[model samples]
Target: MSQISKVVLKDVDGNVLHPQTDAGIVSVNDAAGSPSNVQSEIQALREKQSEMANIDFFVNKGDVNSDADLPAQDYKNGWAYY
Candidate 1:
């Protein structure tokens, strides 16, 4: 009988997606050159959650005929639906 052994993960471009490890440990590469272990990744996500909690989501609700009907107002970081 054959037994399963080591495994290696890769991206479509053939880049190693996971950090080298000898055990069951895992890591996260949130972005290019931003390699972090599972623990640090969790911490970073928690911090981001806290920061996001303070953000206010504004929705510019109104009725419009089409995209051109939208007023010439700054809709940055906000949503507008018609």
Candidate 2:
């Protein structure tokens, strides 16, 4: 099932046929209305995640944007782990 808040009718050249002046086209030329090959995408993402290290904690605390050396010898703007 699909849900639509609004519908637009465009001509072959992609001009809006009956555009409401107050309304606007905010999308990019090549943007997709929905995702394609969803199952394949999900499986690929899961496989990628499984290969990554599960670092669940970090000890360093400092301004990450600074060029100064971080607290730990290895903490180089490394995020608080997921």
Best by TM-score: 1
Query: lDDT tens digits, residues 1-82, model 1?
Result: 3222345678899998875643224656764658665555556667889999997676757778754477687776678655
Tens-place lDDT digits, model 2, residues 1-79? 2222344668899999866421123332222444334333444456668777575446446455547554465544545
Off by over 4 Å in 2: 1-36, 54-75, 78-82
TM-score of each: 0.38, 0.25
Worst 10 residues of 2 by lDDT: 22-31
- For each candidate in the order shown, give its overall lDDT on alpha carbons: 0.63, 0.47
Q: Candidate 1: global Cα-lDDT? A: 0.63
Residues forming the 10-long window of minimal summed lDDT in candidate 1: 1-10
RMSD each, Å? 10.0, 11.7
